[model samples]
Target: MPIRTEAWPQGTPCWIDCQVDDPAKAGEFYAELFGWEIQDGGPESGGYLMAAKSGAAAAGIGPKPEPMAGSPSVWTTYFAVDDADASAEAVARAGGRLVVPAFDVMEFGRMFVAADPTGAVFAVWQARGHNGAAWYSEHGGYVWNELHTHDFDAAKKFYRDIFGYTYTDFDLGDEKYVTFTPPARTESVGGISDDSAARGEPAAYWLTWFQFDDVDAGAKRATELGGTVLQPPTDSPVGRSTLITAPQGEVFGIIDPSKRVGEMPAPTS
Candidate 1:
């Protein structure tokens, strides 16, 4: 089952969560789609719900912060670090902007939100009692995270400086992509792509991909649940995948890796 009991490596993506206007509705949609159990954290937690799979924490759903009113619903990817304060300093030194200052999360961890020089917002976490998600890379769990940025070189440099990441570039005919892994890790943790032109949007953003058993079926179910299928199920070297915006307008992706587990290219530098 690949249940994770230990903390992830520093600079690895260790947790993800969606902030939406309606937490209960979001919980219902994901619980049915991924067979997850929603555990309410009660009032003091501001209605945060931990989405669990097979009785282990997999993700989270919570109400959007008051300051974010009228903004688009979105999922946030959090990277792991040994010290949130130090990471925040690194982010600043790398020309990134901090949206939220480093702060303790009860006894779970310390965290802060920052946007890369390219404007892609992400979080960093320092684990305490909660070491982030307990499972991943399985059906109904997170498999990948990617940042789509307009400034490719700046994005690359900012992340590399902050996280000590190494990159492997892929030449996919007309388009180019680069997979990144934390220092001393062989497995790719995420990727970076210059996709703003294709989407006709200049604002950079992070995308989260969850593993599904059937990509087509998942896309279909999403549409039936009042969600929008931004990209139809399509095959890639790695897997079959689709992009979707949930009923609450938060965007995410799903992939079925049954046919091909594509090999990542060797690190270019």
Candidate 2:
């Protein structure tokens, strides 16, 4: 298991959580699918439930805030930062919009939400008592995150300005995929692609991928639990993967890595 004890570096994706209509039902579904031990965070925590894998924090589940009533359930990815206020300013200066202003989370940390120029929403966290997830890149934990957008150049410039990300493009025959590497990192922290044009709607959004021991079985179980399989299991260079929507309509991906463990790509100039 890749256990994370300290804070993730600035610009690194450090945490993820889903806002759902029914926290209990969502909790049950994920618990069965990922073997997570869902623990209530108590009244002061606003009923947020921390989903743990082998006693380590893996993800979080919480009810949708009243301000966001009637919105579809969706997961939000959070990137680590040293200053939420500064990050929020950088977001607006980079042509992105702030959905929420920076606020303290009872001293655990401060955070704010923003959308990229292409309109894909993400959050930034300045940790205090709480440092994000305790584990990642293992079975039942977050493995990867990617943004699907129509305006690749605009989105790339927005993120590069805000997070100091450098790009490396991979030629995929007819499509070119770009990976964003944080400062001084050899491996990419996330990716951006313009394939949303093929989806027929030109919608931009971030997709999170969780690791699974067996993706075929995981997809089957998800469907059996009232979830929808958007994409059937398919083999890829990285792993066998599938796209799934939870019972309440939150979409995420699952992958079973072909290699025993995943490796970050070598740094590219």
Candidate 3:
């Protein structure tokens, strides 16, 4: 079946944005690593830059909120919807909180930044002829989004209530990663997990993975572009994967898996 149009409100994988201390450095890092073209949106708009690939828009780069503190740099994924207000409402109704209430971006679109019950921050975009990201996963663009949460069931239930998502269970025996879909499709829109970290169990947060043709080559290029590798590419039950950080310190993932982002083969029993 085709992806459920009604459930998503807007199209799947609309756009992503990153808030960093240095936009110029971040722009240069991603431009070389992903083959993206970074164009300035000017200073009045916080010198926001659009990251595009092959002439199609992909993501955005902007300065960090002036008063924001204690948050590590990370890339945030935004899903497109038909109604930002309603989506923000749904988030609150499902036990999640609206970190940043719904607001407009001139004639661009309406947006509301939010966090899941487990504290994973993401955004919702309601396009008014100006959606967030124009292109995705074409050259070096965002291909997938995943969340590492402390409480899988609660997080799963929260998103299900908010977005009406169903899921596929990756039965890793004692533990599993339940990947969610927007309704009809088997492919995942995102994922939920519980993993160990330096500070005991890690807090819940969403992670985004950008696509690259070659995993090893991408890791090497990430280093060459002044980005740091958090986890070297290693074999996963799913694919070879690695964690990385841009020069501005925004964290993201890189995987040149055997399967495409939205086209993974069914998990075996």
Candidate 4:
């Protein structure tokens, strides 16, 4: 288990949460699907529910605020920041716009939401009393996050300026994809994929990937739970995966990392 007692490295994805119409219903859906124990944050927090895996924080399900009522439910990814105030300033300097100005979350932390130049919405968190996720990169927790954008180069430039990210390019055999490394880190934190010519011209958004023990079974369970399977289970370089929309209409990805194919197998195996 990869557990964290403190905060994630600066610029890495630190947390994810979905804003939906009915959080209680959405909480039940996730609890059944991921074997999570949902705990409420009470009235002070607007009934935000924390989904925990093995007694550790994994994700969140919160109700959409008044301004966003009836809007499409979606998962939002948050990046770790040393200072939310500083990050907001950098977002402006880098040509990104702050959707929500820096604000304190009681004693838990400070956070702000922003949109990249490509129109992708994301947030930055400066942890105080509450570190983000207690565990990740495991079943029932987040494994990866990627940005799907129309202007890939513009997206990369904006984030690089904000986080001092360095790029690792992949041909992908279609358009190009690149994974970005935060300053002073060897491991890539997340990916940026170009799909300017995609069939639908999908709006830019951050896609959060959660690990499942069995990808196919997970997809089956999701459908049984009133969710729709957007993409059937497929083997990719990342893992055996599927794209799904929850009952409340939040889009997310599922993968079983142990089922790797091609040349990416574990060394011991």
lDDT (CA) for every model shown?
Answer: 0.89, 0.88, 0.74, 0.89
- Pairs with steric clashes in candidate 1: none
* Candidate 1: regions farther than 4 A off: 261-269
Query: Between prediction 2 and prediction 4, which has the larger TM-score?
Result: 4
lDDT of 2 by residue, 1-269 (tens): 78898888888889999999899899999999999999998999988999999898899999887656797898889999999999999998999998878899997899998889898888898999889999789988999999888888898999899889989987665555788888956788888878744767436888899999899999999999999999999877688899999999899999988633354344343
By summed lDDT, the worst window of 10 consecutive residues in model 3 runs over 1-10
Cα TM-score per model: 0.95, 0.94, 0.86, 0.95
Writing each residue's lDDT as its tens digit, candidate 1 over 1-269 gives 89999888998999999989999999999988889899999887888999999988899998877666788899999999999999999999999999889988888999998889888889998999999989798878898999988788899999999999988898664556898999968888999987745766747999999999998899988888888999988887689999999999999999987756567454445
Each model's number of backbone clashes? 0, 0, 0, 0
RMSD of 1: 1.8
> 1-269 in candidate 3: lDDT tens per residue?
11121223442556778888788888888888888899997766767888877666778988776534556676877877778898888888898888778988877788888888888888888877565555655447776788787778888898888777876777555565777777545566667765533256348777888877788888899898888888887776556778897877778887765733443446652
Tens-digit lDDT string for candidate 4 (219-260): 999999999999999997678999999998899999998887
Instruction: Give the 10-residue window scoring lowest on summed lDDT in candidate 4.
Output: 260-269
Model 1, 108: alpha-carbon shift in Å?
0.5
Q: Candidate 4: which pairs clash?
A: none
Candidate 2 segments exceeding 4 Å error: 259-269
lDDT-better candidate, 2 vs 3: 2
